[model samples]
Target: MDGSFENAAGQARARVALRWRRIGFSALVLGSCAALLGLMAATLFVEAPDPVGIAMLLLFALTLPWTTIGFWNAVIGFSLMTFCRDPAGLVAPHLRSIGGTEKIASSTALLICIRNEDTGRLQRNLGWMLEGLVASGESRWFHLYMLSDSNQAPIIEDEQRVAAELSARFGSALSITYRRREESSGFKAGNIRDFCERWGSLHQFAIVLDADSVMTPAAMLRLVRIMQVQPHIGILQTLVTGLPSASPFARIFQFGMRLGMRSYTLGAASWQGDCGPYWGHNAILRIAPFTEHCHLPVLPGKPPLGGHVLSHDQLEAVLMRRAGYEVRVLPEENGSWEENPPSLPEFIRRDLRWCQGNMQYFHFLSLPRLLPVSRCQLGLAIAMYLGAPAWLGLMTLGLLRQMPIRADLGALLFILTMVMSFAPKFATLADVLARSPLRQAYGGTARILVSAFLEMLFSMLIAPISAVAVTLFMLGLPFGREMGWSTQQRDAEGIPFALAARRLWLQTVLGFVFAVCFWRVVPGAVWLWAPFVLGLAGAIPLAMASADPRVGRALAAVGLCRIPEEARLPAEPEYATLFAPCAPLSPTGATE
Candidate 1:
């Protein structure tokens, strides 16, 4: 009776904590939006409102919430990381350490799903991952499955050849299997569901990996142990950091992302208790519940806007939670890694697909029996992509408002927004410098500071380009333009000038026009928007230079844009054997 009472009490306390968290988050977001919008409104009133000014005010109001949410997320996340308190501490205790390899007794299927990816790199990484598991003495606890969705004959042959070679090399030590589907109807989600339907009952859990994903065996083992200890949890996602890259753009973008993600995701995890995020890969899912409860239903709509759900990760988590299971994330946990797109165009192309996927969430938000936080996540994803267009519109309106806006107030607001958006980066830098090991890993405090400054400046330069590109893409989604899925390009190669121009001519034209207007009417104001204008005006060149491997190699040699992983490679022996070549796989699954 006492034990049951304690359980009930725990449940009641969790409910209270979640309630307070939601209330606090809501209040912060709403308050920030109101304050910013009020300031803009006051400015407009003093200027005397014309229709353009009023339109600017409305757009600013729409856009302020997006910034507000981001600002608070960073603030809350920074606080959480600094204070070192798990947000879900009172409600759920984290399984941080394990006793021994023997303790991780649950059987898990490590599923690596691929579709027209770099097969050679995939094979090499897979070998290392398997070797790492064996080295960690946890190979017996997991099985390996290479599930392919490639429709191309050459790609399928290559994948099978690689699979066969891997099996030949490690078959005695591991349970490895390869399967390819002819009809990849639903894309990745459909691929996963097909696997579940066939072999869902074989394993208690499944760890999903993308073609580019690489998780250390120790990390994989720890994740499974956490699941073993926590029966009610349906999925646990690790905060994946980008692997070492040779592309300057990849390095710059990934470094900033790695720095911010640790703190931001930590805060996100704490607030998102049972409804934590599931980034399609580098996550472990409870096979049975995910198989039974998380089957995705085709939404009632047409292509692009509806049809099969494109962004299925968050929706799956919501569905899992709806069936009385918990989804959690450990943002501080390391060892999960994935590669980034090598160039600007490739990056935007990936974002274009995600933009479509996220926009589709608008239909799912109204579904019955969904949790409030789940709904909030969907709304946030939508707002994330929508914010780009909103900012674009606001910028256009600001230019059109034509009143001599005070440089002082504009500068102040810019600083405020930049600070809110980037406080975590500075905090992360400070956190790194405060610790000797962290500082050394990043080539000391001096290097980190220089990198941060350069990264921030470069990121600012890219902001307008991304904003304009995404805005155009989002606008076209309504007109039945579908972003066709394709293999992600991960090589660092220069984008052709003509191709770059063709893709980004609209952005370039806008930049030229903005520069012409700003130069003619507001020459003094040019400095304020130079980064934005110059970045767009030189879009083709910037894209080319950023994607140049020569630039990336030069930057790395000088210790600029250095991440910890780059300086100190993983200790796994597989990394050492990576350069050793393997023979190609034949059509009949034999090394030719």
Candidate 2:
């Protein structure tokens, strides 16, 4: 009895310490942001005291902090990954001592949700995933369900055909089933809700997956074991990384993301604990809690912001936590994979959709029964999209305001801010070099360094254009411009030059205008603004070149960007020939 009391007291003390660490992290981010804003205010006041200048300063103060938050997140992540032991356990004490061999007493259903997705790719991935489970001899412990919200007739037909094929192949081996909805009312969230209302009671746990998602049987089993041990947890999200892509842009982009995400996820997990994130896919949920608590409410407004919440995952986490269940993320876990947009236009298109979804969070932040941390997370998501326009606005307003002096201090501060924002890339590189196996997997330190450098260059070039595009999308919202849901393009194929131009012309024009204005009206600042302008001006060509398979192949051959997953390829067969019969289907009948 005495030992039990002492253990409980020790656990309480550790929780207090963890809270202090999180508080310190928050202070570092907020305090640095405030200091940066003050410096910008001083610089603006010293230059021009006019209304435009004051507004510019105010906007700068508001926008600059978003970058600071990201900067500090990376910095803290780097520090933790480098120095800390038991990173996951540090955040949530319950997670620290979970028994690995916890018996899996709960029944789980593996769910795959789709909306007008490519049947062949879907079937291929499904087959491979099932094969993994069968190989692991855990197929009996899990049931597979294919849930579709595809509205198009031909696409639905294709889905049925693929279901027939999958049923034919795995009917005897596993319990596989399919269902399609005529109306994709609330999109993925609605599809899942339908499942919950009808079939959720049959299982104690559910593993949710997107159309492009794949996970190994061992990974799935680990997730289940964790849930079995930690019954208080409502959801457990995996740190999903991008699948291998042959496109140069995806190769470079995903490689950097894969490296950085490890550290960032660990740091975030340590802080978030029970108040963690849900990325909609590659996650497990406690069926009873989710069904009872996570039915999303219709925000009291019209379309977009007012109607059904588009960004439901984050809010669902909040609701689950409110209902006395923990929502969590496992950054150290593996065997989760998803596809990224293959090219720039596709990336922007996807970002636009997310931008609208995130922007809608403005309605829910003030909702009753919400946790303060959940509110902060929602605000941060809003700032992410808002920051882009804020940056663009700051630049445009700065260009217009008259400069009293050479603005040397402002220039220095800007450079420092840029460095802080980019520190994560460097930190990731440092981590790569520290691990010998990871370094060799990336083709040695020299190749890794080169890859990082190239990735940074291309990312900088891509950043401004994407920002401007997102800003425009946000602005279009009030005018009733909506982003409709559709199947995402996952291949890394080059788009037509004209199509690229059509998609990126606004950014090109904005870049050209900014360049000419700076050159004629503010020649001294042209050097500072040229990069942003050039990136936008050449957006079309850049997108095309980045998506070119030949370019991606060339870079890969030279070891510019290579992830370990590409080298290993999953052990499960690709089954390319099996998808051959479904190839001749029209694009209208299948997602590309």
Candidate 1: C-alpha RMSD to true structure equals 5.0
| Candidate 2 structure quality by residue, lDDT tens digits, 194-285 | 99998899998999999989887767888898888778889988889877666777878888787677766666666666688999999999
lDDT for each residue of candidate 1 in 73-108, tens digit (9 for 90 to 100): 667776755665554342236555345354777889
All candidates: CA RMSD (Å): 5.0, 4.5
Score residue 507 of candidate 2 by CA lDDT: 89
Roughly what TM-score does model 2 have, to 2 decimal places?
0.93
All candidates' TM-scores?
A: 0.93, 0.93
CA deviation > 4 Å runs, candidate 2: 1-7, 92-99, 525-527, 569-592
Which prediction has the highest lDDT against the true structure?
1
| Global local distance difference test of model 1 | 0.79
